[model samples]
Target: MTIQNRERFLNNVAQHLGRERKTKNVERPSSSLMPQWQVFQHHSQDELADELELQCHSIHTTCKRTNAENLHTVLQETIEELKGQRIIASDDSRNETFGISSLYEDLQKKGITCHIWNSADGQYNLDYAESADVGITFSDITLAESGTVTLFNNSGNGRAISLLPRSYIAIIPKSTLVPRMTQAAKHIHEAEQEGHGVASCVSFITGPSNSADIEMNLIVGVHGPVEVTYILVENR
Candidate 1:
């Protein structure tokens, strides 16, 4: 209302505007003045895979190396190991339930009691899981750097199938096993952007669930699977 008050108000507004401009400038980096850095990029997929394989070997020694030709053999061997121990229960609800159908048939031929349950069926019975030896599931992706398998907990395959069982055997295509987590996150993010809703559950399993909580003694299979074997299928 008064001349002095009007002057003060105008000065305050000018000061606030200046501060806002300065804040934005401080937050933004000057592209022209920024230093350029070199990033070594691999040219071929084999080169990338080799690099990732080395990194993965450092973490897991059991990680098998194979091409598309031997993927079936690898799966067969893994199945044999489970059968020898008598710890495999194939859940073949849908014929499209990853590699379970084949596994189920193989076990059935051998007189193993592998049951098929429908996906539409109600929540999984805990007793079945408790009595079961191992659960088999398909992974959406695998990470070579950490030897991790990524599973989506959705309608096709419930989360309990992987968690409740004492042992989990995952079939993951080698092409899906990325070099790093950032790449994996980018893929998921892009999928979400394309209107596929964020996955209800994204589990990254590197190894069997274990804990050394009691008296500093290590115990496996205390919470989840005691053994986790991954059958990596290369691109065919």
Candidate 2:
């Protein structure tokens, strides 16, 4: 109100503005969760697969490397290891894809009940995946740096296959492996440009669901799959 008081108020405002500008801290380097740095690519396919396996183990996920030709054998072994008699799988139209439609035949021969998810089946697939000993799906993008698999939910590619089952097995082809997240993003973006419909839900799963929130106690499989396994195929 007074001249001197007004001058003091203006000075106080100026000081407050200066302090606000000074409060910003230096930006830190990119982290694993939302990395900003370039993803490191493997020198060879073998190197990439090895790196992915090691990283997956570090995160408590089981990972195995196998050839496309022997993927069926490897998959059977994995299912046997889990004592899984009932399995749910995603159906891939491409015969060469890891989620090939004929996998049903092989599982059936082994006396393992396998259900291939279909949009027409709707809730039946969800219910099957929920109680199935394990659920199988293929990944669109695989990140070796973080051992992460990205699954796009669609009418055919049900999210329940990967999210509802107690054990999840993702089949990833070596060609899908990218050194970093940016490369994977670029690939997905390009695919979208060429008429690939981006789905409503995209899930990037690193490992089994875990939380350490309550009293800093460790808990696993609270929200999603209790265990996760990755099968990296060379010819996928």
Candidate 3:
């Protein structure tokens, strides 16, 4: 075909493609305005704890090769063991007013070195947390259905406290426990939209850090904490 004829054919095809694209875009719904779905809710902290226990038990049973067993007892024992191994508890305003001080005192009497990093002092020192045997922090939210803890990096507790330590013990209040990750993520996303910016990092830790990267042999604490203890403060 002649050059002019080829140009006319290409222009017509481009126009047709543009019209089809516009039609598809118009048909699509706006995600921003869509109603956000709620994943899980609990009537009380006891119920949440029960659900968490069941889920953790299932994981422990299925991952039998890993020698996983009795998460509740493990968590409790870990806390006790950490007390003997030097543990630092991050302080928060909510914790101070929510009976955490008494808990800290109890832990201290047991020989745990609990440190209170107030809002005025601000931020966690990665080097300090790294040197510590264990770093304990509280989660803003937790998912009972999956035995997952949701931590906001920028809040009273930073990611370093959880990531830098050899062991991590998180004290989660029952009231803040959700059913699944979907609910937790939605809450965080909404918080970001409201100017919180979703913290620096959002960690969904189900268990201790582990890997089977070397010769397919399982190794724990390769990159992160070897032990992860979750103390569900049911009454509180």
Top candidate (TM-score): 2
Error of 3 at 31 (Å): 13
All candidates' lDDT scores? 0.60, 0.80, 0.64
lDDT of 1 by residue, 44-157 (tens): 555545654565444332445565566556755775765533333334342333333565567667866554434655554445655566676656776665667787766556
Error of 3 at 121 (Å): 7.2
Give one digit per residue, the lDDT tens place, for model 2 in 169-225.
Answer: 998888878776777788788888999788777888888888999999878898888
* Candidate 1: 10-residue stretch with minimal lDDT: 34-43
Worst 10 residues of 3 by lDDT: 61-70
Q: Cα lDDT for residue 57, model 2?
A: 68
Per-prediction TM-score to the true structure, in the order listed = 0.67, 0.78, 0.66
What clash count does candidate 3 reach? 0
- 53-153 in candidate 3: lDDT tens per residue? 67766433111111112333444366666553555556566555445556667767877666654445454455567677787777788887778888776
Pick the winner on lDDT between candidates 1 and 2.
Answer: 2
Query: Which parts of model 1 have CA positions greater than 4 angstroms off?
Result: 1-61, 65-70, 84-100, 213-218
Model 2 TM-score?
0.78
* Per-residue lDDT value at 35 in model 2: 48
Alpha carbon lDDT at 102, candidate 2: 66
For residue 123, give model 3's deviation from the true position in Å: 9.9
